[model samples]
Target: MNTNGLKVLLIDDTVMILQRLQSLLAEVKQVSRTESATSAEEALVLMDGYQPDVMVLDINMPGMGGIEMLRKLNVKQMIKPVVIMLTNNTFAGYRDECMRLGADYFLDKSRDFLMIPSIVEKVQERNVLQF
Candidate 1:
């Protein structure tokens, strides 16, 4: 993948997590832009202007949770970006629900956070190969 300028949107309520993710994503060769939102509502608003190629989302938020957001996105047919649900919630139900709702990938924030960038890189490579 020529990851020269990939636009990535990260949605997480924790400021520290967001900052960490932003820094990690910045190091990826394919990542060019990184945007963040504290909640699903804020992410929705940001989406109007920034159509990210990839979205790293959290399952829990103040207003709309990641599952609800994914359902809404599916209903509206807004599934262009590869949605990766990154959350601390590791319940089977939550994982199953997210996958059914159109999340391309689901990762536990504590255990799988470090794997995100590599996953994104692989996704980018797959996308490039598809073309």
Candidate 2:
């Protein structure tokens, strides 16, 4: 996969969170496109039309939370996007659970929100080196 430009999918219940993350990622040259979904269910629907290279997900939602969505993605064998679980819940259980469920990165929304662009850039760099 060409990582020079990455397509990112942002899934969160909050509009502000989505907008903030989108704007932050927009500044990064590596990000070619971004799509946002207010819920995991909506994201799943969007996935049929868009295969993202990276997924920035929230752990908690009204229905079909991020963890459940991750399981569905694995079971369905969807295009394996690099999963980044970004949430305000920084509990150890959530972190471990997310990692076990195939999350590449688990970031605390409060402390790690600003690090997303750098993380995406690093993923792009790593993919470039892999090829």
Candidate 3:
């Protein structure tokens, strides 16, 4: 893992949202690589090849939602990536469930989308400091 750069994986069913996030993260100096998956299954497959330092996941999708994916990750005890749940779901239940399931951060897609880059940058800075 490169402490200087963040390998970010974005999971969102909406192509526009994915593109927007990719474009936003591109401006951040700490982000070296970015990948997008429209589904949890696709994200899992992508993870096999590219282990991301941070993951931006959406709660609603065709199959295996973000919360369920977090549960699976917890059960498998996989490479414990820093998970940031970015979803349009505004329910407190969803937010609480995601946090309980191991989400490092939860943000509403409609209101907090712009915060992603700053959060990723902070995560990168923290990673660098840890070393």
Candidate 4:
């Protein structure tokens, strides 16, 4: 994996949200690549071929939600990518649950939506330092 740039996987049911995230991350120099999945199930399948360094996930989705996906990822023991929980539901309970489930960061979609790229850049910086 490149320490200078991060491969980001975006999992959200909403196409517009995914597109916006992709567009936003595209402007960040630290983000080398971006992929999107309309649902957590699709993201899990995609992870087989594409190992992302970071994941921007939504808590609400059809079929399987982000919280369930996190549990599934843990069970798979796959690469533990930096998980960022982004959602419109910013309730304290949700934030606490996501963090407890191993989310590296939790951001309110309405307020922190614009902070994604900067957060990704920071995560890249940490990766560089770790390597």
Candidate 5:
């Protein structure tokens, strides 16, 4: 981890996915804090408080999917934290749309969960704070 005490917000609609991600990130020593949300609405509320440096989100949520949340976040002109999408949808169109909508990374849920740390690692290594 490039940052000594980085905080991350992990959001997903499923409890299982959230738990699995949390466990993967637990191995990294630099991540000092982790806040999670199961819905976009809940995540919005948490965002005002936690203000995480990085956000890993899942698209296709029940309500207020990842793209929707990004749209909402844009209105506030937030710091635009580095958002990595964890989704089952891997279509080229969806990935392109997410990038256009402010998502920095689009990853497959089935194969990318294990790479969370690596993604964060690269982001931290670049030292581009508040991406």
Candidate 6:
């Protein structure tokens, strides 16, 4: 199933990780728009203008973490974007908490990025309004 140009937002504190992920996502034809934010505030600001179909976010950061951002965005109840939690920490609690906070998937960045495609495919299959 093709996602057909789904908008994507990726938020991470690391500059290198953000760039690498953006490049990887860009390789997918269905990913038309891929935006990156180094902070939760920046991501939130971007969201105000562009409503993405799915968001791949980091769980840990300086000010507001992934869970905090997700919770806040959800409170608005405007766009229910599927969240794929990206984290270096693979602790059970972290995974459980992310799932509890409405993460569609959890990815460990310390490992190779093999599951991203599948995660995106799953999200597309589940929530793509045009699919």
Best-fitting candidate, scored by lDDT? 2
Question: What TM-score, computed on C-alpha atoms, does each candidate reach?
Answer: 0.93, 0.94, 0.94, 0.94, 0.89, 0.87
Residue 123, candidate 3: Cα error in Å is: 0.5
> Candidate 4: TM-score?
0.94
| Candidate 5 residue pairs that clash | none
What is candidate 6's CA lDDT for residue 38?
95
Sort the candidates on lDDT, descending order. 2, 4, 3, 1, 5, 6
lDDT tens string, model 3, 75-130? 87567788999987879999899999999999988899999889998998898789
How would you encode candidate 6's per-residue C-alpha lDDT over 1-131 as one tens digit per residue? Answer: 34456788989999998888877876676676888899998999998787888888998999999889978876875767888888888899988988887887888887736677666666666655654
Model 2's alpha-carbon lDDT is 0.92
What would the per-residue lDDT of candidate 1 be over residues 1-131, giving only the tens digit for each residue? 44366789999999999999999987898887889999999998888788888999999999899899888777764547889999888999999999998898989988889998998898789878988
- Lowest summed lDDT window (length 10), candidate 4: 1-10
Model 3 has how many clashing residue pairs? 0
> Which residue pairs clash within candidate 4?
none
Q: Write the per-residue lDDT of candidate 4 for residues 1-131, one digit (tens) a residue.
A: 33458899999999999999989988888888889999999999998788889999999999999999998888885569999999999889988988888899999898989989898999889988887
In model 2, which runs have C-alpha deviations exceeding 4 angstroms? Answer: 1-4
Q: Provide backbone clash counts, one per model.
A: 1, 0, 0, 0, 0, 0
* Model 1 RMSD, rounded to 1 decimal: 2.0
User: Stretches of candidate 4 above 4 Å error?
Assistant: 1-4
Query: lDDT tens digits, residues 21-119, model 5?
Result: 889888876677789999989999998878887899988898789888988888884587889988999999889988998898899988776888988
- The 10 consecutive residues of candidate 3 with the worst lDDT sum are 1-10
